[model samples]
Target chain A: MKILKQLKMTCKDTSPLISESMDGHISFGKRLRLKIHLTICKACQCYKNQLEIIKNLAKKIGSEDFSSKKNQTLRPEVKEKIKQSLNNI
Target chain B: MNDRQLDSSMWVDRYGDIMYRYTLLRVKNVDFAEEIVQNTFLAAIQAQANYAGRSAEKSWLFGILKHKIMDHFRSQKRFQSFNQSDSDDSSVDDYDDSGHWKIFPKDWGLDPEKAAENTELAHRLEECMSGLSEKFRQIFIMKEMDGIDSTQICNEFDIKPTNLWVILHRARNQLKLCLEAHWFQNKTSE
Candidate 1:
């Protein structure tokens, strides 16, 4: 019975779909499994859509370099120091 | 100097700043982030023999920096469970699980593009981040901002793959809800 519940859960959980949808790292098996789940479940579909949006928003944040100002300010001394340290070692 | 040390030094010179920036995004403290970057380079120097040259050196350093970030978080006692009142069922229940999805206009209701365009969204994200529980914040920043792979994150955090997924889901959900409540609700009211 516990195995049956586990099987049911393996059947019920839409994590594979959500994970693939978010990360774009879907495996062939996970893709087929997701198709099977989405064929029957509507909630997972909406969840997947929201997940995509969240993922895209995150991508936008990554594209924008919030650290550019700091990057530009790497003092020549620091660069020289790093170079010297690497040279000495 | 040994060839390994020479090659590692060259790699660090090329990629250290990028790694430092990645760590900074996750750790949110310059000094700590720099320390992690230093450790990542030091570890790379030590482990250069093990590097099979499978991935780009940048990716390899990133992999190490990621571990260092997680170590910093763990040492700071920031590794905590994501406790929420909403059960998993309730959290995901709002949407249909089927593949059919509607891509409605994502107003997020905040017009994050406008916020981002205004140059305040960065700080807004930072402020909103400060409100999160430390674990959620770290996980979100690492996965979302640093573009670290989930499997690598799981290995670093010493968490099961399942636990990593749940933490990521809850963190994203919490961040979305926080942004909506703090920044978007007023837009809707208008």
Candidate 2:
């Protein structure tokens, strides 16, 4: 049952499937296959999520605002202003 | 157990920095981060009745802050264009010859929330990213960060869909190894 064996998918085969699924490109069959693999594989699951967070954080870097004020804490005036408005509520 | 316990009093003073740190890590803009944090507070005040007070106060506030951040990202997604422009034509081999990882993924033992919170880990990610090839860096960002459609990327890069996935696999794998070496290694030692 070589066909059946291949259907099982390997960490290697499943790796690309993980990335492909993120782009909404993987087929239902492959998606199902990837899900099955992930159930048994912790590492691939870890890879799936780590890439996601990195992607989320990196999205900000790629945005136009990347060049603007970065990593600064809330200003005291803005803090004061928000506090006052909340108090008004 | 009521609205009084959920009072907005001292909210800005108490949760201000915590909210700012979380949003800044996600949005990476000081002004924007401040805006979202402010909105989060406002939203909390509006939804003040929803705080069941079963969860910790900080987490309850954090939950609202996350929703506000996601809403911002979703609205921002409309203008999300890559330099390539979209005709829409479209579009991790972390394994070895036999299709198994040469070495299994070493659990960094950090959950996504914890990993995202670690400022030092974020710096390591930036450094590891810098080490990827220019093409790897570009495609990874285009696919992962830019949220570009896979087929559209294929059309823009003039590469087959299969090749794009291969490139992503390598790029992700490389980042994994680099982070393991830089961040997790130190984490274990500590």
Q: Among these predicted structures, which one has the highest lDDT?
A: 2
Give per-model TM-scores: 0.53, 0.53
Put down candidate 1 lDDT per residue, B91-137, tens digits, no spaces.
45434464222332134533323444533445445556667766667
Q: Once model 2 is optimally superposed onto the true structure by TM-score, how far is the C-alpha of residue B125 displaced, in angstroms?
A: 1.3
Q: DockQ each candidate and list the results.
A: 0.16, 0.28
Work out candidate 1's RMSD over C-alphas.
8.1
Error of 2 at B152 (Å): 4.0
Candidate 2, residue B38: the lDDT equals 92
Query: In model 1, which runs have C-alpha deviations exceeding 4 angstroms?
Result: A1-50, A59-81, B1-13, B46-57, B77-127, B142-166, B181-190
**Clash pairs (backbone) in predicted model 2:** B90-B151, B90-B152, B91-B151, B91-B152, B92-B169
* The TM-score obtained for chain B of candidate 2 when compared with the true chain B: 0.51
Worst 10 residues of 1 chain B by lDDT: B98-107
Please report, in order, the local distance difference test score of every candidate based on alpha carbons.
0.59, 0.69
Query: Pick by TM-score: which candidate is best?
Result: 1
